[model samples]
Target: MSPRRSRKTSFEDKMARLEAIVEELEKGGLELEKAISLFKEGTKLVEELSEMLRDAEIEIENLYSEDDLNGD
Candidate 1:
């Protein structure tokens, strides 16, 4: 039998794009047109991802920082 997959599919990719967009905006070098477009895209991506997270909850395994991986 195949192992079942976990983690939100494409979730990390969307987050990466959003981070890039914010970085571009913060750089303050983009032309107004490009900045506005990136801002719009970033807002949309944030909303979509927020909705995805809102629909579910998952226990995080904070193995790197805390013992027992958190509030288990």
Candidate 2:
């Protein structure tokens, strides 16, 4: 993959990439180096998505608290 393609990768995009990775792994055609790199990238994607979700949840909770405090 190109550097630009790798940089803009998102949760959904990475999930799709990971699905392709799985299919490739299942098909047993990728070289060891490529497979390892894909696995590492997929791990990064999982962590990135998890952190994004945690931040989103915190924001949602804060918004709810603010609404309650405002007597809305």
Candidate 3:
């Protein structure tokens, strides 16, 4: 996926695509080039998804820390 398209795509959509790629790879019989292409895309999606999760975790932590500071 292009960087622009990926930026617009939601995390759930990327995860679904990654799952589909894994299923296809697992099933076998893909041409070597196609399989490699799918593998690259899957890895890219994994990186993007991991970053998104990390960002969310940081945001949540910050929110809770702010609450603690406020004695809420």
| CA RMSD of all predictions | 10.7, 7.8, 7.4
Largest lDDT belongs to which candidate? 3
lDDT of 1 by residue, 1-72 (tens): 332333444678789999999988998988999999999999999998998779566778645666545745
TM-score ranking of the models:
3, 1, 2
Q: What is candidate 2's CA lDDT for residue 52?
A: 54
Error of 2 at 56 (Å): 7.7
In model 3, the Cα lDDT at residue 62 comes to 56
Residue runs of model 1 more than 4 Å from their true location after superposition = 1-9, 55-72
CA deviation > 4 Å runs, candidate 2 = 1-9, 55-57, 60-72
Model 2's TM-score against the true structure: 0.51
- Per-residue accuracy of model 2 over 1-72 as CA lDDT, tens digit each: 887767556657867876776777778878999989878877787777677567453333365677588897
Give per-model TM-scores: 0.64, 0.51, 0.64
Local distance difference test, each candidate: 0.82, 0.73, 0.88
**Winner on TM-score (1 vs 2):** 1
Cα lDDT tens digits, model 3, 1-72, are 898786667777998999999999999999999999999999999998898777453333355676688896
Task: Estimate candidate 2's alpha-carbon lDDT, on a 0 to 1 scale.
Answer: 0.73
